[model samples]
Target: MTPTTEHRPQMSVEEFEELERHAPETVRLEFINGKVQVKAVTDGNHDQIVAWLQRLCMQHRPELWLYAERGMKVEAYRRGRARPDGVLAPFGFAKGHGDWSEAEGVLMTVEVTSHDADTHQRDRVEKPGGYAAAGIPVYLLVDREDRTVTVFSDPEDGRYRLQVNKPFGAVIDLPDPVNITLDTEPLEDLAT
Candidate 1:
Protein backbone atom coordinates (compact mmCIF):
# COMPACT_ATOMS: atom_id res chain seq x y z
CA MET A 1 0.00 0.00 0.00
CA THR A 2 1.09 3.56 -0.67
CA PRO A 3 2.16 5.51 2.39
CA THR A 4 -0.22 8.35 3.21
CA THR A 5 0.63 11.50 5.10
CA GLU A 6 -2.67 13.15 5.92
CA HIS A 7 -1.62 16.36 7.53
CA ARG A 8 -5.10 17.82 7.68
CA PRO A 9 -8.75 16.91 7.31
CA GLN A 10 -9.55 19.01 4.26
CA MET A 11 -7.20 20.77 1.84
CA SER A 12 -7.80 23.48 -0.71
CA VAL A 13 -5.95 23.68 -4.01
CA GLU A 14 -3.68 26.35 -2.62
CA GLU A 15 -2.77 24.22 0.37
CA PHE A 16 -2.30 21.13 -1.78
CA GLU A 17 0.16 22.93 -4.02
CA GLU A 18 2.06 24.32 -1.07
CA LEU A 19 2.67 20.86 0.35
CA GLU A 20 3.29 19.33 -3.08
CA ARG A 21 5.93 21.92 -3.94
CA HIS A 22 7.98 21.17 -0.83
CA ALA A 23 7.38 17.40 -0.85
CA PRO A 24 10.28 15.13 -1.68
CA GLU A 25 11.03 14.25 -5.28
CA THR A 26 10.12 10.62 -4.70
CA VAL A 27 6.63 11.39 -3.46
CA ARG A 28 3.69 11.07 -5.86
CA LEU A 29 0.54 12.82 -4.69
CA GLU A 30 -2.79 14.09 -6.04
CA PHE A 31 -5.40 16.53 -4.74
CA ILE A 32 -8.75 14.77 -4.90
CA ASN A 33 -12.09 15.79 -3.42
CA GLY A 34 -10.70 18.05 -0.66
CA LYS A 35 -8.13 15.42 0.24
CA VAL A 36 -4.53 14.95 -0.75
CA GLN A 37 -3.85 11.31 -1.62
CA VAL A 38 -0.31 10.02 -1.76
CA LYS A 39 0.57 7.47 -4.44
CA ALA A 40 2.90 4.57 -4.06
CA VAL A 41 6.49 5.25 -5.02
CA THR A 42 6.86 4.10 -8.61
CA ASP A 43 9.03 1.11 -9.34
CA GLY A 44 11.08 0.15 -12.39
CA ASN A 45 8.41 -2.30 -13.56
CA HIS A 46 5.73 0.35 -13.40
CA ASP A 47 7.89 2.87 -15.23
CA GLN A 48 8.62 0.48 -18.06
CA ILE A 49 4.91 0.06 -18.77
CA VAL A 50 4.32 3.83 -18.74
CA ALA A 51 7.16 4.49 -21.16
CA TRP A 52 5.96 1.76 -23.47
CA LEU A 53 2.44 3.17 -23.49
CA GLN A 54 3.75 6.58 -24.50
CA ARG A 55 5.72 5.16 -27.37
CA LEU A 56 2.89 2.95 -28.53
CA CYS A 57 0.42 5.83 -28.39
CA MET A 58 2.73 7.99 -30.39
CA GLN A 59 2.90 5.36 -33.06
CA HIS A 60 -0.89 5.42 -33.26
CA ARG A 61 -0.98 9.16 -33.93
CA PRO A 62 2.09 11.21 -34.58
CA GLU A 63 0.01 14.35 -34.21
CA LEU A 64 -1.31 13.61 -30.73
CA TRP A 65 0.67 14.15 -27.53
CA LEU A 66 0.46 11.42 -24.90
CA TYR A 67 1.78 12.74 -21.62
CA ALA A 68 2.49 11.06 -18.33
CA GLU A 69 1.97 12.54 -14.86
CA ARG A 70 -0.28 15.32 -16.12
CA GLY A 71 -2.67 16.77 -13.54
CA MET A 72 -6.29 16.60 -14.63
CA LYS A 73 -7.88 20.05 -14.58
CA VAL A 74 -11.31 19.37 -13.13
CA GLU A 75 -13.50 22.33 -12.27
CA ALA A 76 -15.76 20.61 -9.75
CA TYR A 77 -14.97 20.91 -6.06
CA ARG A 78 -13.72 18.04 -3.83
CA ARG A 79 -13.01 15.82 -6.86
CA GLY A 80 -11.23 18.87 -8.14
CA ARG A 81 -7.96 17.52 -9.54
CA ALA A 82 -6.40 14.20 -10.51
CA ARG A 83 -3.13 13.12 -12.08
CA PRO A 84 -3.61 10.41 -14.64
CA ASP A 85 -0.90 7.85 -15.21
CA GLY A 86 -1.05 8.69 -18.91
CA VAL A 87 -3.01 11.59 -20.44
CA LEU A 88 -3.74 11.88 -24.16
CA ALA A 89 -4.14 15.40 -25.47
CA PRO A 90 -4.75 16.76 -28.95
CA PHE A 91 -1.94 18.21 -30.98
CA GLY A 92 -0.35 21.25 -29.24
CA PHE A 93 -2.51 20.83 -26.13
CA ALA A 94 -0.41 22.09 -23.22
CA LYS A 95 1.31 19.40 -21.14
CA GLY A 96 3.85 21.68 -19.52
CA HIS A 97 3.90 22.27 -15.79
CA GLY A 98 1.51 24.78 -14.22
CA ASP A 99 -0.31 25.27 -17.53
CA TRP A 100 -3.59 23.62 -16.66
CA SER A 101 -5.38 21.90 -19.53
CA GLU A 102 -9.15 21.80 -19.23
CA ALA A 103 -10.68 18.33 -19.09
CA GLU A 104 -12.25 18.73 -22.49
CA GLY A 105 -10.35 17.53 -25.56
CA VAL A 106 -8.52 14.95 -23.52
CA LEU A 107 -8.80 11.82 -25.66
CA MET A 108 -8.13 9.49 -22.79
CA THR A 109 -6.82 9.04 -19.24
CA VAL A 110 -5.01 5.85 -18.21
CA GLU A 111 -4.82 4.61 -14.64
CA VAL A 112 -2.45 1.73 -13.93
CA THR A 113 -3.50 0.22 -10.62
CA SER A 114 -1.11 0.20 -7.69
CA HIS A 115 -0.96 -2.11 -4.70
CA ASP A 116 -2.56 0.45 -2.35
CA ALA A 117 -6.25 -0.16 -1.73
CA ASP A 118 -6.94 3.57 -1.48
CA THR A 119 -5.13 4.18 -4.73
CA HIS A 120 -6.93 1.28 -6.32
CA GLN A 121 -10.31 2.65 -5.28
CA ARG A 122 -9.35 6.07 -6.51
CA ASP A 123 -8.48 4.63 -9.89
CA ARG A 124 -11.32 2.18 -10.34
CA VAL A 125 -14.15 4.27 -8.92
CA GLU A 126 -13.30 7.90 -8.21
CA LYS A 127 -11.33 8.76 -11.32
CA PRO A 128 -13.65 7.12 -13.84
CA GLY A 129 -16.66 8.96 -12.47
CA GLY A 130 -14.74 12.23 -12.27
CA TYR A 131 -13.35 11.91 -15.79
CA ALA A 132 -16.77 11.09 -17.17
CA ALA A 133 -18.25 14.07 -15.40
CA ALA A 134 -15.59 16.20 -17.09
CA GLY A 135 -16.70 14.80 -20.47
CA ILE A 136 -13.43 13.13 -21.28
CA PRO A 137 -14.09 10.67 -24.10
CA VAL A 138 -12.25 7.70 -22.72
CA TYR A 139 -10.80 6.19 -19.54
CA LEU A 140 -8.42 3.23 -19.84
CA LEU A 141 -7.70 1.36 -16.64
CA VAL A 142 -5.01 -1.25 -16.30
CA ASP A 143 -6.06 -3.34 -13.37
CA ARG A 144 -3.36 -5.42 -11.73
CA GLU A 145 -5.82 -6.91 -9.27
CA ASP A 146 -8.12 -8.15 -12.03
CA ARG A 147 -5.34 -8.78 -14.51
CA THR A 148 -7.42 -7.03 -17.13
CA VAL A 149 -7.69 -3.78 -19.04
CA THR A 150 -10.93 -1.81 -19.18
CA VAL A 151 -11.89 0.93 -21.60
CA PHE A 152 -14.70 3.27 -20.65
CA SER A 153 -16.26 5.44 -23.32
CA ASP A 154 -19.33 7.44 -24.33
CA PRO A 155 -19.51 9.63 -21.26
CA GLU A 156 -23.12 10.61 -20.62
CA ASP A 157 -24.47 12.41 -17.59
CA GLY A 158 -21.36 11.92 -15.45
CA ARG A 159 -20.76 8.28 -16.30
CA TYR A 160 -19.49 6.07 -19.08
CA ARG A 161 -22.23 4.14 -20.86
CA LEU A 162 -19.94 1.63 -22.49
CA GLN A 163 -17.21 -0.42 -20.88
CA VAL A 164 -15.19 -3.19 -22.52
CA ASN A 165 -12.77 -5.23 -20.45
CA LYS A 166 -10.21 -7.72 -21.69
CA PRO A 167 -7.60 -9.83 -19.99
CA PHE A 168 -3.89 -9.31 -20.50
CA GLY A 169 -2.42 -10.57 -23.80
CA ALA A 170 -5.68 -9.73 -25.56
CA VAL A 171 -6.32 -6.85 -27.93
CA ILE A 172 -8.40 -3.90 -26.65
CA ASP A 173 -10.17 -2.07 -29.44
CA LEU A 174 -10.90 1.61 -29.03
CA PRO A 175 -13.79 3.31 -30.82
CA ASP A 176 -14.42 6.53 -32.73
CA PRO A 177 -12.29 9.67 -32.04
CA VAL A 178 -9.63 7.13 -31.06
CA ASN A 179 -9.45 4.38 -33.66
CA ILE A 180 -6.73 2.05 -32.54
CA THR A 181 -6.23 -1.39 -31.04
CA LEU A 182 -3.93 -1.60 -28.06
CA ASP A 183 -2.05 -4.84 -27.61
CA THR A 184 -1.94 -5.71 -23.92
CA GLU A 185 0.55 -8.55 -24.36
CA PRO A 186 3.48 -6.68 -22.87
CA LEU A 187 1.44 -5.71 -19.84
CA GLU A 188 0.85 -9.36 -18.91
CA ASP A 189 4.00 -9.58 -16.85
CA LEU A 190 2.99 -6.57 -14.78
CA ALA A 191 -0.32 -8.26 -13.99
CA THR A 192 1.47 -11.32 -12.72
Candidate 2:
Protein backbone atom coordinates (compact mmCIF):
# COMPACT_ATOMS: atom_id res chain seq x y z
CA MET A 1 0.00 0.00 0.00
CA THR A 2 1.16 3.50 -0.87
CA PRO A 3 1.58 6.28 1.65
CA THR A 4 -1.25 8.68 2.31
CA THR A 5 -0.87 12.39 2.87
CA GLU A 6 -1.91 14.72 5.67
CA HIS A 7 -2.40 18.43 5.98
CA ARG A 8 0.85 20.29 6.54
CA PRO A 9 1.97 23.88 6.36
CA GLN A 10 3.53 24.79 3.01
CA MET A 11 6.55 26.93 2.33
CA SER A 12 7.86 28.63 -0.76
CA VAL A 13 11.05 27.80 -2.67
CA GLU A 14 12.90 30.68 -1.05
CA GLU A 15 11.92 29.49 2.40
CA PHE A 16 12.99 25.97 1.57
CA GLU A 17 16.38 27.20 0.37
CA GLU A 18 16.82 29.20 3.51
CA LEU A 19 16.16 26.12 5.64
CA GLU A 20 18.59 24.07 3.59
CA ARG A 21 21.30 26.70 3.99
CA HIS A 22 20.84 26.85 7.73
CA ALA A 23 20.55 23.09 8.20
CA PRO A 24 23.45 21.37 9.95
CA GLU A 25 25.87 19.25 7.96
CA THR A 26 24.72 16.02 9.54
CA VAL A 27 21.07 16.76 8.85
CA ARG A 28 19.94 16.24 5.27
CA LEU A 29 16.92 18.21 4.15
CA GLU A 30 14.62 17.78 1.15
CA PHE A 31 11.56 19.64 -0.10
CA ILE A 32 8.40 17.80 -1.05
CA ASN A 33 5.21 19.61 -1.98
CA GLY A 34 6.40 22.70 -0.13
CA LYS A 35 7.09 20.67 3.04
CA VAL A 36 10.57 20.13 4.40
CA GLN A 37 11.72 16.67 5.38
CA VAL A 38 14.79 15.73 7.34
CA LYS A 39 16.49 12.52 6.20
CA ALA A 40 17.99 10.11 8.68
CA VAL A 41 21.59 8.93 8.62
CA THR A 42 22.00 5.77 6.56
CA ASP A 43 22.52 2.41 8.23
CA GLY A 44 25.47 0.10 7.71
CA ASN A 45 23.80 -1.70 4.82
CA HIS A 46 22.84 1.53 3.11
CA ASP A 47 26.33 2.92 3.47
CA GLN A 48 27.91 -0.26 2.18
CA ILE A 49 25.65 -0.46 -0.85
CA VAL A 50 26.29 3.19 -1.68
CA ALA A 51 30.04 2.74 -1.43
CA TRP A 52 30.03 -0.46 -3.48
CA LEU A 53 27.89 1.03 -6.20
CA GLN A 54 30.05 4.13 -6.33
CA ARG A 55 33.17 2.05 -6.73
CA LEU A 56 31.62 -0.06 -9.49
CA CYS A 57 30.41 3.00 -11.34
CA MET A 58 33.81 4.64 -11.10
CA GLN A 59 35.50 1.62 -12.60
CA HIS A 60 33.10 1.57 -15.55
CA ARG A 61 33.61 5.29 -16.26
CA PRO A 62 30.48 5.52 -18.35
CA GLU A 63 30.81 9.31 -18.47
CA LEU A 64 27.75 9.30 -16.28
CA TRP A 65 27.71 11.53 -13.23
CA LEU A 66 26.75 9.83 -9.97
CA TYR A 67 25.74 11.51 -6.74
CA ALA A 68 24.95 9.94 -3.37
CA GLU A 69 22.47 11.55 -1.05
CA ARG A 70 22.82 14.78 -2.98
CA GLY A 71 20.08 17.36 -2.95
CA MET A 72 18.20 17.26 -6.27
CA LYS A 73 15.56 19.91 -6.80
CA VAL A 74 13.29 18.48 -9.45
CA GLU A 75 10.23 20.30 -10.77
CA ALA A 76 6.85 18.82 -9.98
CA TYR A 77 3.40 19.96 -11.02
CA ARG A 78 1.38 20.48 -7.83
CA ARG A 79 4.24 19.53 -5.52
CA GLY A 80 7.12 21.96 -6.03
CA ARG A 81 10.18 19.75 -5.52
CA ALA A 82 10.99 16.04 -5.68
CA ARG A 83 14.39 14.68 -4.68
CA PRO A 84 15.57 11.12 -5.18
CA ASP A 85 18.25 9.11 -3.39
CA GLY A 86 20.91 9.07 -6.08
CA VAL A 87 20.71 11.03 -9.32
CA LEU A 88 22.66 10.02 -12.42
CA ALA A 89 23.47 12.74 -14.89
CA PRO A 90 24.61 12.43 -18.48
CA PHE A 91 28.23 11.60 -19.01
CA GLY A 92 30.87 14.31 -18.70
CA PHE A 93 28.69 16.57 -16.60
CA ALA A 94 28.97 17.74 -13.01
CA LYS A 95 26.16 19.00 -10.83
CA GLY A 96 26.40 22.28 -8.91
CA HIS A 97 28.99 23.60 -11.31
CA GLY A 98 29.19 27.32 -11.76
CA ASP A 99 25.78 28.74 -12.62
CA TRP A 100 24.06 25.37 -12.47
CA SER A 101 20.89 24.49 -10.60
CA GLU A 102 19.95 21.25 -8.92
CA ALA A 103 16.90 21.26 -11.11
CA GLU A 104 18.83 20.17 -14.16
CA GLY A 105 18.30 17.41 -16.65
CA VAL A 106 18.91 14.00 -15.11
CA LEU A 107 19.41 10.70 -16.95
CA MET A 108 18.63 8.35 -14.09
CA THR A 109 17.82 8.38 -10.37
CA VAL A 110 17.85 5.77 -7.59
CA GLU A 111 16.15 5.33 -4.23
CA VAL A 112 16.91 2.88 -1.47
CA THR A 113 13.79 1.58 0.25
CA SER A 114 13.17 2.48 3.86
CA HIS A 115 11.95 0.20 6.64
CA ASP A 116 8.62 1.91 6.58
CA ALA A 117 6.42 0.56 3.79
CA ASP A 118 4.91 3.99 3.32
CA THR A 119 8.32 5.49 2.77
CA HIS A 120 9.09 2.80 0.24
CA GLN A 121 5.84 3.48 -1.54
CA ARG A 122 6.61 7.18 -1.62
CA ASP A 123 9.81 6.55 -3.48
CA ARG A 124 8.44 3.77 -5.65
CA VAL A 125 5.28 5.53 -6.68
CA GLU A 126 5.25 9.27 -5.99
CA LYS A 127 8.83 10.12 -6.95
CA PRO A 128 8.75 8.03 -10.12
CA GLY A 129 5.81 9.97 -11.46
CA GLY A 130 7.59 13.22 -10.71
CA TYR A 131 10.79 11.97 -12.34
CA ALA A 132 8.93 10.70 -15.39
CA ALA A 133 7.20 14.03 -15.77
CA ALA A 134 10.64 15.61 -15.52
CA GLY A 135 11.66 13.37 -18.45
CA ILE A 136 14.23 11.36 -16.52
CA PRO A 137 15.18 8.26 -18.50
CA VAL A 138 15.54 5.67 -15.75
CA TYR A 139 14.83 5.13 -12.05
CA LEU A 140 16.23 2.40 -9.80
CA LEU A 141 15.01 1.17 -6.43
CA VAL A 142 17.05 -0.98 -4.06
CA ASP A 143 15.05 -2.92 -1.50
CA ARG A 144 17.48 -3.88 1.22
CA GLU A 145 15.19 -6.22 3.14
CA ASP A 146 13.89 -7.94 0.04
CA ARG A 147 17.39 -8.03 -1.46
CA THR A 148 15.94 -6.95 -4.77
CA VAL A 149 16.56 -4.16 -7.24
CA THR A 150 13.89 -2.71 -9.46
CA VAL A 151 14.62 -0.74 -12.60
CA PHE A 152 11.96 1.51 -14.07
CA SER A 153 12.43 2.72 -17.63
CA ASP A 154 10.75 3.67 -20.90
CA PRO A 155 8.71 6.62 -19.78
CA GLU A 156 5.55 7.25 -21.75
CA ASP A 157 2.65 9.59 -21.05
CA GLY A 158 4.52 11.07 -18.10
CA ARG A 159 5.10 7.71 -16.39
CA TYR A 160 7.34 4.70 -16.62
CA ARG A 161 6.04 1.94 -18.92
CA LEU A 162 8.63 -0.78 -18.35
CA GLN A 163 9.67 -2.20 -14.99
CA VAL A 164 12.36 -4.81 -14.32
CA ASN A 165 12.96 -6.49 -10.98
CA LYS A 166 16.00 -8.60 -10.10
CA PRO A 167 17.21 -10.29 -6.97
CA PHE A 168 20.64 -10.44 -5.37
CA GLY A 169 23.50 -11.89 -7.50
CA ALA A 170 21.61 -10.82 -10.61
CA VAL A 171 23.46 -8.78 -13.20
CA ILE A 172 21.55 -5.55 -13.69
CA ASP A 173 21.91 -3.55 -16.88
CA LEU A 174 21.51 0.19 -17.02
CA PRO A 175 20.20 2.21 -19.93
CA ASP A 176 22.36 3.09 -22.95
CA PRO A 177 22.95 6.53 -21.51
CA VAL A 178 24.60 4.71 -18.64
CA ASN A 179 26.02 1.50 -20.04
CA ILE A 180 27.11 -0.23 -16.86
CA THR A 181 26.41 -3.55 -15.16
CA LEU A 182 25.97 -4.05 -11.43
CA ASP A 183 26.47 -7.38 -9.67
CA THR A 184 24.22 -7.60 -6.66
CA GLU A 185 26.44 -10.08 -4.83
CA PRO A 186 28.44 -7.37 -3.11
CA LEU A 187 25.27 -5.60 -2.09
CA GLU A 188 23.83 -8.79 -0.68
CA ASP A 189 27.02 -9.50 1.20
CA LEU A 190 26.85 -6.06 2.73
CA ALA A 191 23.28 -6.64 3.79
CA THR A 192 24.38 -9.51 5.96
Most lDDT-accurate candidate: 1
lDDT of 1: 0.79
**In model 1, which regions exceed 4 Å deviation?**
1-9, 75-79, 95-99
Candidate 1 residue-wise lDDT, 69-172, digit = tens: 78776535434677788888777776354734678778988888887768666888778888888888888988877889999999987789999999989999
Query: How much is the lDDT of residue 15 in candidate 1?
Result: 73
Per-residue accuracy of model 2 over 76-165 as CA lDDT, tens digit each: 543445446677765545534531235456767888766654565467666777667666788888877778888888876768888889
Model 1 reaches what TM-score against the true structure?
0.86
Name the 10 consecutive residues with the lowest summed lDDT in model 1.
Answer: 72-81
- Measured against the true structure, the TM-scores of the candidates, in listed sequence, are 0.86, 0.79
Please give the distance, in angstroms, between residue 17's alpha carbon in candidate 1 and its true position after superposition.
2.4
Task: Assess each prediction's global lDDT (C-alpha) against the native.
Answer: 0.79, 0.68
Note the clash tally of each candidate.
Answer: 2, 1
